[model samples]
Target: MSGEWQHGLLGCFDNFTLCLISWLVPCYQFGKNAEAVGESCLICGLGFLVPVVDIFLAIHIRGKIRESKGIQGSLIGDLLYWCFCPLCSLVQEAQEVGGAPQAISMGRE
Candidate 1:
């Protein structure tokens, strides 16, 4: 695993399906991300209902992902992503954990 986000915030458009999923159902994306990093998806899904706590939990989940995957990042960076561009962050997380686009496609075969 790389020590960084697989895609930049603005690069979400590169994966339209993931971008749309993140945009239309952010909580679902968050839950998926949580599951990928060995966290409790149910707790994350429930946390999304609370505004402030959700942001913190999202950051925590991102941190855990980074730690588990050896992704290099700082709290400030996590805060910025979680606060200003959560959908992009979620899409990036999905891409990283789910493997490359080709790898994901191959799995369905």
Candidate 2:
């Protein structure tokens, strides 16, 4: 696996609207990232409600995204990323999973 994140964390200005949304409603942004990678939005969203567990869950979701997309990253990196800058991490995942510029559709076809 040798892929990289499509967008940088601090490059939120690339999508100012998403940056605002991410800053305002991080859980919602995280939920969108989770759904994009085929995780349960409700479950992931709920995880963020708890402070301690949210870090672990965020790392788990990031790992899922990395694995699914063949992106290169480590557990420590994920932990640190979520620990220090969760909003940027969420936005990065959203970009990686192609959910940044669009709304996450919950309805099944």
| Candidate that would win on TM-score | 2
lDDT of 1 by residue, 1-109 (tens): 7666767767887777877777888787788788888888888978977989998987898888888888898888899988888777888887777722332454544
Q: What overall lDDT goes with each candidate model?
A: 0.79, 0.84
Clashing pairs in 1: none
Error of 2 at 84 (Å): 1.2
lDDT tens per residue, model 2, 3-66: 8877887777777777888788888888888898888888888888898889888999999999
Q: Cα miss at 18, model 1 (Å)?
A: 1.3
Q: What would the TM-scores of all predictions be?
A: 0.82, 0.85
Per-residue error (Å), model 1, residue 69? 1.8
Q: Estimate the lDDT of model 1.
A: 0.79
Give the least accurate 10-residue stretch of model 1, judged by summed lDDT: 99-108
Model 1: CA > 4 A from native: 99-109
lDDT of model 1 at position 16: 78
